[model samples]
Target: MYKNKYEPALDIYRRTLDNQLKLIHGDHRDIAASLSGISWALGYIGHTEEALEYSMQSLAIQQRCTPSYHPMLAHTLRAI
Candidate 1:
């Protein structure tokens, strides 16, 4: 279930973000996704403001990718 993903996904996002500066940079796509994931994690951990921030970031990317209301973007919004 998605709820279950909250933990591990958050862990991975955190790890990636932590090592991001040293490991890689220049692409906001993955970073945006990571931030969004972290936002969701923060939301799951009870940080709504942060979660909304991440969700909006992801939403921006999703809109650029889809440019319309696709199933994926819909789901992402629903998640928020």
Candidate 2:
């Protein structure tokens, strides 16, 4: 099933996000990247609301930490 295929990926993304949060004190590109990973996994798993939330969070972090023209920001925007 689609859920079975993506569930493991979602779990990994969540764990990675947790680790990134613990290691990084504030908004960082790594954190944003983790969030984006989670968002992608969640979206594939059919958790659209949560996916959008994570995508927004990632976008916010990217906007704050990276240049406005950063590829990551553009990616997050497209994801949202």
State the weakest 10-residue window (summed lDDT) of model 1.
Answer: 21-30
Per-candidate TM vs. native? Answer: 0.60, 0.91
What lDDT would each prediction earn against the true structure? 0.73, 0.89
What does candidate 2's lDDT look like per residue over 1-80, in tens digits? 55466778888888988888888898899999989998998898789999999999999899999999999899889888
Error of 2 at 51 (Å): 0.3
Q: After aligning candidate 2 to the native by TM-score, how far in Å is the CA of 76 from where it should be?
A: 0.7
With candidate 1 superimposed using the best TM-score fit, by how many Å does residue 10's alpha carbon deviate from the native?
A: 2.8
The TM-score of candidate 1 is 0.60
Q: Across residues 1-80, which tens digit of lDDT does each residue of candidate 1 receive?
A: 56556778788888987786456555445565676678878887787987887788777877776646567577677877
Off by over 4 Å in 1: 1-9, 17-32, 67-69
Estimate the overall C-alpha local distance difference test score of candidate 2: 0.89
**How many clashes (backbone N, Cα, C below 3 Å) per candidate?**
0, 0
